[model samples]
Target chain A: MDTHAAYKSRWLPWVLLLPSFVILLVFLYYPTIETFVLSLFQVAFLGLSKSFVGLENYKILFTDPDYRQIFKNTVVFAFFVVIFSMAVGLALSVLANQRVTGWRIYRLLLIWPYALSPAVAGVIFLFMFNPQSGIVNYLLEISLGVAPDWLTNPTLAMALLVFVAVWKNVGYNVVFYIAGLQNLPGEVLEAALIDGATPWQRFWRVTFPLLSPMTFFLLIINTIYAFFEAFPFVDLLTKGGPSNATNILIFNIYRDGFEYYKTGMAAAQSVILFIAVVFLTILQFRLGEGRVHYGG
Target chain B: MKRLVTVIGLSALLGFAFAAEKVQITFWHAFGGGRTAFIQRAVEDFNYTHPGIEVKVEYKGSYRDTLNAAILAAKQGNAPHIVQIFEVGSQLAIDSGIFVPIQDFVPAGLEFQLDDYIKPVANYYRIGGKFNSIPWNSSNPILYYNKDIFKKAGLDPNNPPKTYNEVVQACEKIIASKAAPKCITWPLHSWFVEQWIAEQGALLANNENGRAARATDVYINSEAMKRIMKWWKGLYDKGYYAYTGKPEDWDGANQLFVSKQAAMEITSTSDVTFMQNASFENGFELGTGFLPTADGVERNGTVVGGASLWLTKGHPQKEQEAALTFLLWFTNTENMVRWHKGTGYFPVLNTSVKVLEWQHWFERNPAYRAAFDQLLQSKANRATQGALIGPFPEVRTIIENMIQEIFQGKDLAKALAEADAKADQALKRYNASVKK
Candidate 1:
């Protein structure tokens, strides 16, 4: 009877998990496996005829300078986006947590950018930074006596893209940070304050340490978001433009796959990107284990 | 009593069986807005005239999107009976082997009087002396200028810039007079670029812009192209031009023109309706002119920019016949005249032009005659023929990138050379893959 009961309990958990398991297998694993298979062959709109060209697509991707530059650009874009987003999100969350007047309104205004679609945000940025007639340039010229071609300048274009990405995404991180801040034990902060710790001292020594788990979570999530989610803005605003300065890995993958119809090459590039993201994520987790505090 | 009831039922069934089969043919097109209404009207008329057949038309987004969707669907065995592929995609569609030749559907030995079609327009759809698809709603790029802006800039409103030098001079005057922020605007489209190259009688690609056959090489970095790029670069350097950055940013340029902020704009003749309907603050009148030419170079004809109706394979003989009948009706003279008058597209049938002339429509709307006259007067040269590159959409993106580079102050010659190298590599790969 006990063995039967144990078996029933074991099957019950699986039965409860069955729906999610099937959903993941169908939606995620199936497409991933198909994409992997497609990567081994040359596919087009005409028809799919597979011929074994083992590692040939990978060779082409690795040998191409454009792909290398695109990889570097993507890494750079992601790094800047994550760093800027975390900094801004943390600051905004901390400020909102303070018992200031109308703090809720400020918080609402701060996180409002997260509500915008990336494509719409990209258009708004494009108009705001347009060289000829953008409001940003107009303001800059009138106040600072300088108006640079923000989109046309290769050096500034990527920076502008990172700025836009952070502006649009930092609000999402702020929500996470605010939750982390609110969930913190009040006794720990009160104890630190009673022990002659100042506000900055308490934040740096106690509060920041307690928020390490949240910081780690935000880091991983923001990195992935920067890698994949920020690509549409780059496509819409710059089109990997100003002499391919803004071309990132996923954008290059899209250009090669859909626009150029170089399916195998794009798949190979995607595999590379996947491997890189996995490696970075593992490294982040490994590094954060020593620093992250799970409890007060 | 049973026998009497059975006899009555059998007679009723026989009477119902004698009724015609409701033939349904699916037509996928990229037409929307006013053009969609015109096509819907044509479908309604065709259905009314032919009691047995019903044509179902579906709007499938832009020309490129429609072609991509149809090609994908054809591979999956779900393609429509008829698809409206753009002119550039015609070669790709023909090479794909999924479409049934229109000539094959028509009765054998029944000459369709192919000579009735305008030579250049019909020749575009012809592959080795056999027409592949029926050309419909064809248009060419033309210059659209604001007369009020021209007057303010001290330029002749009637006689717009004819030569490239004159265009530059007029742009400068317009800018200097503060009539417009930028004197002129050109939408960044490959078709328009090809048209400009053809206007200078420069070959865009080998093999007669690939009309003779499929192109394996791109001549985008030729001397004439370099010259044109240099001229555009000069204009950009002088602040007489502005790049909208987005390929679909013609709305901004149109707004600029309508607001009397831009003196001149070059776009498709199809944009005539949009320009005509735009509410202008200063009440500007539009001036239509032929595309400008370089000094001492005659203007070559602009290539067709609209979509054509393609018949897909894998349909019953009756359905095929019904599709062909629909195509014939869609391109008939009266239908063509109605389509042309309704949309800004020039009628594909010469008889439709004659009919319009008889009706005094062209006399009342003289601006609409500019594209027709320009096309008719153009010499049938290889340069003026359209590009038929296999991976043309990809090639266009590459060219757009090169243009962006130029806008960023890259050396035009070097940039074009690099772009040419990349495009040739792409062409070679595309040609090899498409090879039987």
Candidate 2:
């Protein structure tokens, strides 16, 4: 078979791609452009009224202390979630990859958290960490003679959100890493072993470098997850509460748009969040392009 | 086989004809759990009794979600015939221009008994001397205390705290006696602040609580709010207040009280039935009282905090009429009594209250008496009617977050100032957008 089919008509190729392009235009491009335009206006009464105010919405975002705090919270939350999930995911994947008798069961158990939606996970954690009657507090009171307020305390709330996000996302990361581990050229690691390299050195100098491509891919996936997919956890658990301590950007957008009916402000927030994730992803790619060691 | 097929086809045709003859109207409400079941039962009764109208009831997620869904659906020209909007969303609902004031649907000289409705509730939903929506489920906050804890602390179980000083004194004895881990708890909700401000006979916003004009400023930083916050902060500082740490965590507060972790909780009267069940389940005696007010301030009564049913515009005349019929029947005296008995919400009809009193309903459910007495004792004022603001939900969230910040050691003055600024900004944007 020919490596590439040479179409005789240029319009034919365009026509063939029309379906996907149209879908992207309708679902992706139109909404993004609409959100950008809507962000310039002050929308009221669930968009029964709208008046353009130029960059007033964006200016508010820049000047508003609450929005600034949310932005900082998002960054901090994303950083911790990405780092911890990836590290824990890699460790778990390595263990699951071992040729132990119950390795299948271990993998299945480790991957079950990924099957639960963020909202469900949030609900589970919410009951467990409830300050009044949650099992966590009940157990702590029994053992430590002190029960910390889990959902209400600002620091603890944020920490709990990060913890839940990492716990939910680690399974996803582990799945990818396991596939990456199975695909790694065993000969390279074996050569390192034969050349008198220690197990740790073999991992860092050979196996780790070989898995860079997977790591790069996981980095982008985890960052996007942290940015957007972490919303439900915050919503179900904290509701961006206890003084906006755990209020991430996405949750703030939801509150403004859906709860408060401040569509224009929420649209403005959406644009900012979009730009932030795009910039972060681009930065990840630029950095990864230099370091990712793709094997021949 | 041919005979069976013929019979099935005929029945299908008949079913379609039957469904088409009825004026179908959809009703979206914000009730969940057992209350949803109660609403379903009422709607079924309505459907069963009114054969010409098929009232389809839907359980929308929450008051905010229901209102938003209605507005969005209205924009799409698929709005339900009726939507239950919280009292705080009254201004927004009216300003949306998508709802037909229920008064418009009232036939002239029909003896609709509009005047028979309770003053506070009617006042809350009525704008410009006309009811914008039919007041349905209405509630006010009341104090729920564990009588056993009160007795354990040597405080009179029957007589609950009525003022901030009395609450603090009670808390002192309760804490000193170690009856419970905390003395009191309430959802860190802005509703309480609004109620307390009303209790002090202070308006939450200018222009007669936005009844005279569109609200442009919020009184979050006013002296009235300061007094409320100071008292609240004092309890927090003294470690007598149980801080659930979440904003608007009504269930958490309820748990703290029901589980005997806290001796008292101030929550909505709608939770009266829940409290009764919880006290039974948790093996405690529940006592109810009027929500405590600031010291030395004459109580002005709490505002109505539940929702009302609004008729959406753009429906067919038949559907609209059917929706009006459903709304009227849903809030009629008989149904109101049933609603009150089923849920702890106020029976918003004077006739319903009369019937309940005549029936001696309150004697059996004495805990409900506290809520009813509080509502009756409330003076009809702009504050008690509650503030009408376009951005009420946002302003509430800000106030709640501010309270949380203050609880976490943020300077009270700074938190109030910040909350006031944010609330005013929201009001400005809302007013501007609606003005255009």
Candidate 3:
């Protein structure tokens, strides 16, 4: 409570945390502010000269239908990835919770998809779905007597991307869900069973309600992953292809930034994406607050 | 005790004072697999001949990756002495001011024999009559076909597709015969599309395909492009052609061709060795031809696609001299012939070609001469000179996406028009930023 005593404690903590704070400020905050500033100017390769455009880049982004489509695709991708991953993850977690044979192996198998890099996963999917040589087509031809070009069809391409995203991410989500489910009190479930509740009733009234926090966490993380981390797959597999069906926001950013060298436009798109993600996250938190149950 | 202490101290001091004998120069390349091994061998040969200079060659991913890494490293003052940059990045590298022009090091008027190099290859690196970089590995697109499938389909294996219509007919025959599911597999590279346009005597960009000046606008939605797109769409509709997903999916396409799933493939000449080697197991003979033309139009030329060696700035005088020496040695007649034979890339220097001819290497292997013939047959026209747009890499992606959309049954004209407009906007942005 004395001035010297308070200063000693405060100064000690500040000194201990200085290096980390400096790193965050230099790497994260500095680049973020610099990007915002760069967004207002026209930047070029081979030179440091930049001229202020003052909202012109943003105007172009707004007027351009390509950017609008990319924005929509990104949002839609994030939505489907979050919802489906959570649904599949929750279902798998509940299934694994049952005292069944080989559940450990099932759990391990579920998590294995997460270990493969997205680029490798994209290549594997490409081969598996190749119209001529792929097993998918072989089975389709054998069973249905018809095979469709999955990568070349616009609708099917979008669906394939969403399927790959869920496939790659659901495992990680299941791991989190299992941890959450295992932490729930056994007595509470036993009480429900003693009350003569059916399995569906117990899950709907107790287990599902208790898993909300885990669901919320998975929702945020999966949404971000779908938005950013899925770009590599798009780059490698579809390349935002089949007529821009799979061209999400991050892929557009990469194309504009590195491929096109349109840094200002890319920066503008990035800012918009950042704001969109922030808004969605806030909305998720606001809606989740009413639904998520935290068991003390 | 004092005498033993003095003897031990002398040896310790001597060991600590002596520095390593070699001066290590980092060389960043885009080569991988067998080509990477070839480059490593070349570096080892250089190291063996020149004991003082130890070249440490590192594969910094692909062409795009190496350029990006080099640019970033230059900003951080840690760039490699020599960086391998793809042709698309030539202008960007030249404009960066981070590279020391090869012309600057080689004595002026001393006759590095600029004329001895292939015209187009030399022209790619020359800006305002000064060489910006040295052409290391050069390749052009050519048609590769599965001869077994051709023969199986009752088509002449010796006579490959010469026109667009013939290509389609051949595809239909292959498909009808059930010899191959798809008649051909096209790699999704915009450069290929550009080459196709040029080969038909059409321009994809203004200013003679940007050879005379920097391209500020795109003219890709022209009649020639539309015709090519229509042909492509027809092939796709008939299930005659298959898309290989990405530009680097040549290996997948090669596998499909070798496995008898596809009858034809048109890829870089650099893939010749791979095709030949893979054909051994399948017992399918490999056939090579020039890319097909549209209607009665004669084949103008195909543009080159490969990486060149760039000398980055900020090295000491001795280091610059060392880099110059390495470049000279690497591009010398003997080394160039060795590189050309080892890898499928055509030698950039005339002397190397002559040396190969003198050695009767070409006579022994006639299939390896198609790329050289195509390059020589090409006239010095604006259409065949290649594009030098500021945002070419990005523009290429847009064009590729447009083609993909067309393949997915989108209206070809509308897609191309939209791509053209978007590319124009991108070009404007690029121009506005770079304009003096």
Candidate 2: lDDT of A194? 91
lDDT of 1 by residue, B233-338 (tens): 7777887766555554666556556665567878778777677666344577888898887677666666767878889999888988888888887888888888
- List the candidates ranked by DockQ, beginning with the highest: 2, 3, 1
Candidate 1, residues A9-43, lDDT tens digits: the string is 65787888899999999999997787777677665
Report how closely model 1 matches the true complex, as a DockQ value.
0.37
lDDT of candidate 2 over B1-436, digit per residue (tens): 9999999999999999998999988999889998899899999999999999998899989888898889989999999998999988889888999998788787666336678889888788789889988888899999999999999999999999999999999999999999998999998888888899999999989889999988778888999999988899999889898856667778878878988999999999999998999899999999999999998888888899898888989877878877877888888999999999888999999999999999998998899999999999999989898999888988998998888888788988898998998999888878888889
- DockQ of candidate 2 is 0.72
Docking class of 2: medium
lDDT of 2 by residue, A115-172 (tens): 9977889878987888767898889999998889887688889999999999998899
Q: Which pairs clash (backbone N, Cα, C closer than 3 Å) in model 2?
A: A152-B245
Q: What is the TM-score of chain B alone in each candidate?
A: 0.92, 0.97, 0.93
Candidate 2: deviation at residue A148, Å?
A: 2.6
Which has the greatest lDDT? Answer: 2
After superposition, the stretches of candidate 3 with alpha carbons farther than 4 Å from their true spots are A1-8, B1-24, B108-110, B246-248
DockQ of 3: 0.54
iRMSD in angstroms, per model: 2.8, 1.4, 2.4
Of 2 and 3, the candidate ahead on DockQ is 2
Q: Rank the candidates by lDDT, best first.
A: 2, 3, 1
Q: Give the top-scoring candidate (DockQ).
A: 2
Q: lDDT per prediction?
A: 0.80, 0.89, 0.81
Q: Candidate 3: which pairs clash? A: none
What is candidate 3's TM-score for chain A? Answer: 0.95
